[model samples]
Target: MFMNIYPKAYISSLSDVKADYFKEKGIKGLILDLDNTIIPWKAAILQPEMADLLKGYQASGLNLCVVSNAFNRRVVGLLEPLGIPGVAWARKPRRKSFLKAMDILGTTPAETAVVGDQLFTDIWGGNRLGLYTVLVIPISKKEFFGTRFVRLLEKFVLNRLAKKGVIEIPE
Candidate 1:
């Protein structure tokens, strides 16, 4: 039961996971979370360095799509410049959006990965479809009020997972 929310890997940030690493894992496509996963919470700007990293991933032959709970304008505004498609208002931890993203990427579950900061949304959503899941530490301390409440529970779960050797939390 606990494994459902557990990610296959956890890292400090998106930049830590390299293109070559994804290639080695046979991941040809990625379903990325927007807000905290890509930019800081509620922020639309994608840093130049992050943009370069994303472009490099694309250059390395990985298809990318943004799956966000935010409205269309916000998701599209940020990703349009990067030529990345997105599914906004994605009610994740549900299969529909993830399936839609897979369709957009034209990749099977085995060939795709979902990267995000939240376990309840991104990780759970990806795991449901057997997609590789990578949980990144939230980029900033600032976040939604509801998310702040969930983070308290998320921390407890992470501690348990770490103690069980299911994942390693950095000190």
Candidate 2:
């Protein structure tokens, strides 16, 4: 039960995940969360460094798709410049949206990874499908009220997982 919510790996930031690392892991595609995972919750656009990093990932032949719970307009607007497809208003941790993302990328679960900051949404969804999961630190302290609530539960689970030697937490 706890393993379902634990990420396969934890990194300080999205930038910590290198393109070669993804390739080395046989990751052919990425299902990414927009808020916090990609950009700060309140950020209107992708940062310059993030854009470059994403471009590098793309150049390495990895397909990318954004799966965000935000409205269509917001998700589309941000991802358009990056040329990445997105499914907005995706109620995550649900298999439908994740399966749809894999379909969009034309990749199987084993060939893709779900990357995000939230455990319930990203890690649970990915692990449920047997897709690799990568957890990143939230970009900023600011976030939605509901996400703030989930973070509390996530903290407890993370602590337990760390104590059990199931996952590593950065110091």
Task: Please state the error at residue 119 of candidate 1 in Å.
Answer: 0.9
Top TM-score: which candidate number?
1
- CA lDDT of every candidate: 0.91, 0.88
User: lDDT tens string, model 1, 1-171?
Assistant: 555998888889888778988888899999999988999988869999889999999999999999998999989999999999999999998899999999999999999999999999999999999999988989889976777888998889888887889974322
> Could you tell me which 10 consecutive residues in candidate 2 have the lowest summed lDDT?
162-171
Candidate 1 displacement at residue 100 in angstroms:
0.6
The prediction achieving the highest lDDT against the true structure is 1
Candidate 1 achieves a global lDDT of 0.91
Clashing pairs in 2: none
Cα lDDT tens digits, model 2, 64-103, are: 9999988999999999998999999899988899999999
CA deviation > 4 Å runs, candidate 1: 1-3, 168-171
